[model samples]
Target: MRESLGDFAIGRLDAEEAATVQAHLDGCADCRAELAEVSSVLGPLSTVDAARLGDAPVPSPDLGDRIVAAARAEGRAAERGRSTPRRLTLAAAAAVALLVGGAGGYAAGAYDGIPREPVAVQAMEPGVEVSAVAIPHTWGVEIVLDGDGFASGATYRMVVESKDGREVGAGEFIGTGESKMVCNMNSSVLRGDAEGFKVVDTSGATVLRGDLTAT
Candidate 1:
């Protein structure tokens, strides 16, 4: 029931009705998909700055037309070979957020302003995988690490250091071997002078190391 999707998504329905709707969503992929799309459209609006909406600067004259065209194209692509996808409606809402909020520029994605080229870092220890990307403008780098050999229930420290032998950031996280860890080195550590980076365990053993030179 498309009418019930919004109520279910927002917890507005009573427990009995909500449970029944949830069960239907679980068994119906189309309704579940529509719920996700509706959530995307509603979620941003809910959190958006009310003051910003009031004072949002006037977008370009053609921005509205462009957004509609882009949204239609996106909807067509998403709905191809399927029943009408709600993604286009969601896209239109998102496009409004982007254009209006560009005044308060935010990253479109992780590593949004970062350099496109990825610097390959090799794992010094077995069963560890690390991927890192450095951003030139922000002078920041993000590391995604997966360790499949760490102790199951133990807490460990992940450390990052600059090439000049200065400790940039350190954080403790509890993780299992099957999970991925994300580490972000702020601009303080990514000041374009870091020629090397390191990840050390709690015992002060290096798990991964790499050069930061532009690749």
Candidate 2:
């Protein structure tokens, strides 16, 4: 995973580390997008200055269990067919989430928390869009969302829930001069049993629903 927090704006890390990365971000758009992605799922992370940099993010309850179970399922499925790319993507995602939790809070709404307005989800574009594909030896869980055509600098929000009534990743998305987002979650509830995952808006409406995939 990209260990450089060059673009990360708000997080639970200390000053020295945050500064090193922020300096890099001032010139990297990719990092800016990443920082945006993190804030999108979290909240107005821009509110985070270099002053308050070192704080641990609170991971939602049972996220690890949910992730492990999903990973096992993906491993079994991958045994039937190889998918190294998917596994790698998940590894990166898992590592990133772990890092975020180490310093930030599981406080999604704090940064990108959406308004009370209902969400209108666009379809996930193929080829150009990001998708959480099949995972090989997948030992974690993820929630991904993406779309196109937006009003620029738009912020999208998501409230995910496993069938067990536990919130997975309650976050928002900052659009990339367009109306699309991708929130990949590898949470605590994935270690054991979970029926499925569903995405929602601030009003508690369903946007997407399906079983946990391999990657």
Candidate 3:
């Protein structure tokens, strides 16, 4: 029959849909004839009885050798396939756009010959800036932001805090240009078992934070 009913032909519809299709099939002799033809072609096979299917075909006595040869041939083919490899960009093109934007920070005279530390701008929209904090016993914290366009040079700082209050300990470690930085806490920071953590920058400002859950 000119049909490929898939799971539908088995009368396996759950409820409402089953009733509808069953009704249609019952009234449709053409569909029934197609099913019959399929059944005839199948003969005793029916639903592909595994019991009567018999053992799988045995290979020739030299099967092991043949298999090894085939594997070698395949490996050679794979080696050849691997040969035509393409080079990747030093940084993803998008990174260039982000670096210009703020994903990596910039200095007042970053574009000039003046040397300065680069700031990591969040790679996400609306770029993040440091604000204030009130946590406790946190040591060092590093971070990577999500967004594009970071400044080339400039140190992003954290909001300052005292030894008491909510500010027990806190800080961050920043690299020149990175999507992620580390956070060293004064205490074991359990960021709700998150994928990442957050932190403040050098000047005691909220510089980095994001994605905390799982990889």
Candidate 4:
């Protein structure tokens, strides 16, 4: 049940599995606490720049051994019915270290085989400046955006339009209106089928548009 908390936090579990997890969490105080901790870690990790991960410092050679040791210690504590918080913390730390050490491989697999392509972003309204990059994957496309000059506290949606005039919702982000805004959005629409990308406000007004054909 504890092992499934990570997947449950990210909504990766199937309906039945998720329901079971939810039911268990409703009664398990320890698992609920651990789930909150894991969720906090995942939220920031999701925004990590994968392109820069290649430059991350290599971990110590013994990192893998340390992680395995931590896991074994955690299992031993569980079997003994001892307080597991210390062992759990150690295990979590080891897992995070492993992810940092293997970030290069993770980035390579995440982007698939397609090279990152710069999309030409055109401002749809005055005083708006935005830029985007399109990364195509086997499953679909990921858009990386960096910009400013949006309505603060407003929600913006990314819409990907196919060549046939069909539109697919990519993802959404909140605007800060000040400072640079960075967001990563994904869509199930294949890159080859997408003709353009549009960032629109909640009112359906376009703020920025990008041409995928030239990407």
Tens-place lDDT per residue, model 1, 1-215, is 66999988888999999988888887665578799998888867788888677785888899989999999999998778454446676788799777745643222233332323355677877877656654443445544443355555666564556667777664555646766544444445653556666666767787777667653
What CA root-mean-square deviation does each model show from the true structure? 21.6, 22.3, 17.7, 20.9
Which should have the higher TM-score, number 1 or number 3? 1
- Give Cα distance to truth, residue 97, candidate 1, Å: 14
TM-score of each: 0.40, 0.29, 0.27, 0.49
Report the C-alpha lDDT of model 2 over 1-215, residue by residue, as the tens digit: 24554334445567887877777677554467777676675555456776667776789999999999999999998886667877889999899778766754332222222211112333332222333321111243434443443224645454444557776664565545454544454444542333455544345555455454221
Best by TM-score: 4
Please rank every candidate by lDDT, starting with the best: 4, 1, 2, 3
Per-residue accuracy of model 3 over 51-131 as CA lDDT, tens digit each: 867978778999999999999999998787664342234345566657755743432223323222223233232344332
What local lDDT score does residue 178 receive in model 4, on the 0 to 100 scale? 68
Task: Write the candidate numbers in order of decreasing TM-score.
Answer: 4, 1, 2, 3
| Poorest lDDT segment (10 consecutive residues) of candidate 1 | 104-113
Residue-level error in angstroms, candidate 3, position 6: 9.5
Q: List model 4 lDDT by residue over 29-48, tens digit each.
A: 55787999999999799999
Error of 4 at 118 (Å): 0.5
Question: What is the TM-score of candidate 1?
Answer: 0.40
